[model samples]
Target: MEISPDAIIILKWNGIHINATIVFTWAVMVILVFISWMATKNLTIGPKISRWQNFLEVIVGYMRQQVREITQQNPDPFIPFLGTLFLFISVSNLLDIIPGYQPPTGSLSTTSALAICVFFAIPIFGIAKKGIRDYFKHYLEPSIFMMPFNIIGDFSRTLALAVRLFGNVMSGTLIVAVLLLITPLFVPIVMQILGLLIGQIQAYIFTVLATVYIASATRIENKPNKIEQKEGSKENE
Candidate 1:
């Protein structure tokens, strides 16, 4: 059985090959863009909004709330990036129920790319909020000796994020495939439903972890210091 979408080449020309991973990833992107356009084209402020608009609003609001809760700061800036990550992975995995369709997320390369985006995003968000000097200072907290280990920790988490998503997704696909071969018809159907649920969950976990990482980077440390000073002044008075 084919383990990865990359192994299924759909086009070959002039020594270049296009695989199922590329095809499906683009397909998912197009679908999302088209749906988004359709949902917003006729957006209404009154009580007569379309169901699609209502559904999208609900999703966006929930995501914003999640980001706010995690970061304890304004959620507007982070929504676009975190929301896209959640939507893409969730949609790609949800599409696995379609027969003969391989989720691009089942491929390691795709997951790695997503993880790398998150890896860079950490620094970008950090530097944006704290400036380059202050953001990098965290790596040397307490002493310069810890800087190397802090850097290694960042790399290690990025690796974990990629492998975790890829392994869960690929394994889910593999299980469903194996069940189809040996199990009766009804059994595979149930597994497919379970797989869809798992896919949504993986999307949530990945996005939340990313939010936590970015939140850590962007957190302002001055508040606690000020609170302590106030307390000390009160004690002195």
Candidate 2:
């Protein structure tokens, strides 16, 4: 029934305290890293593969495909970042089935931190792909008058991303809690299943939005490249 994991303070020192969000976030990271290591410890390409290796490969391939479809850029470069984001959020959402666990994602702080990461990543990826000059020039698109608006758009989008995730996750947890209190058994079970579905959808959505934003930032210059390539083809013909 806790709204935020901040309610669950694990330690206090010098008037500072570590909360459930921090603890659970760390737990999620450790669990994910450990599972990955264990699963891929004996990966092989010799035809006879372990089920774990197969499962890992399938998941990785699916994520890579998703990145490629979204960005139209090389997926390998983006996979590690986007893939980890999707996996962490999805796994955090799925873990809600465990009794007496509060998903760290239910916290606004955590979601905002994630959103901030994406906000910074957009510029980092854009600059790397296009260059700092081109990336900044994008903010002045259509005219210099739009620069302030564009900067505002940047912050507003980050806020939206964070709030969107926080609202979905917190609302899901709230609904489940109410169901548990009222029906307590059968109804809550069904809601739990539905919540899992919603959680996964949210994960995909968050990842796709992130991919789209990065792609928009980086791909602006590529349009001219395509046009020139087409023009060159016509000249050769």
Candidate 3:
């Protein structure tokens, strides 16, 4: 309904710089931490489930399944990071509908920062699992000549992740604002629901893509065994 300020003014030692996006992202992080703690505290494998616990279980299970499918292997290791990403983005996107809250993911700063985290994490996980030399060699990919292309592709994918998320969430925010401005009564409700669906989809897409990237980075390509046997000497040559 109301337009969120592009940035917020923050107190500094010497001066104040207005950066609403950063402040909003900080709020999202705090909320995420609280949610994570609550979920972990009440963890159980029994049939009974609390409301909060059930909600959390649904999200965690979905992300875990997605990651396992993408990697075609167990996803226990990635469950935490990917699950957190999905929950944080989904909740952050919904916050915009609250009276005075704004969705941090709508801001380029927030999405880009998240994408950067994924970028760094991909390499870190790859190196941790496959060793540094092999991890770097993966950038060469299909062939040596494709190294430059593969590197560029990786950078572009990361950039795309940032821009795509920011654009989608911002678009929903702008549309909802415009609808509320035109019809103040009940039209915005529908827009909010639409925003929810869009937000969830975007979150899912982001996490899935991250899982795919991480899987590719960690996958061990089968190498041909170098057994240089004398084919001509097979017949006693």
lDDT values for all models? 0.89, 0.83, 0.77
- Cα lDDT tens digits for candidate 3, 1-237: 334335555544466565666677778889888877887897778998788889877867777787787676689988887877887898888786687667878878788988999999899878988999999987665689999987897788788889889888989888878888799778888888899899988987888778777877777773212111211121121
Instruction: Give all TM-scores, in the order shown.
Output: 0.91, 0.91, 0.82
* Candidate 1: residue pairs that collide: none
Per-residue lDDT of model 1, residues 42-114, tens digit only: 9999998999999999999999999998788999999999999999999999999888889999999899999
The better candidate by lDDT, 1 or 3, is 1
For candidate 2, write residues 33-81 as lDDT tens digits: 9989998888787999988789889999999887787677788978888
Candidate 1: C-alpha lDDT: 0.89
Which model scores highest in lDDT? 1
Native-vs-model 3 lDDT? 0.77
What total of clashing residue pairs does each candidate reach? 0, 0, 3
Model 3, runs deviating above 4 Å: 1-6, 10-13, 16-18, 42-49, 222-237
- Report per-prediction Cα RMSD to one decimal: 7.5, 7.1, 10.2
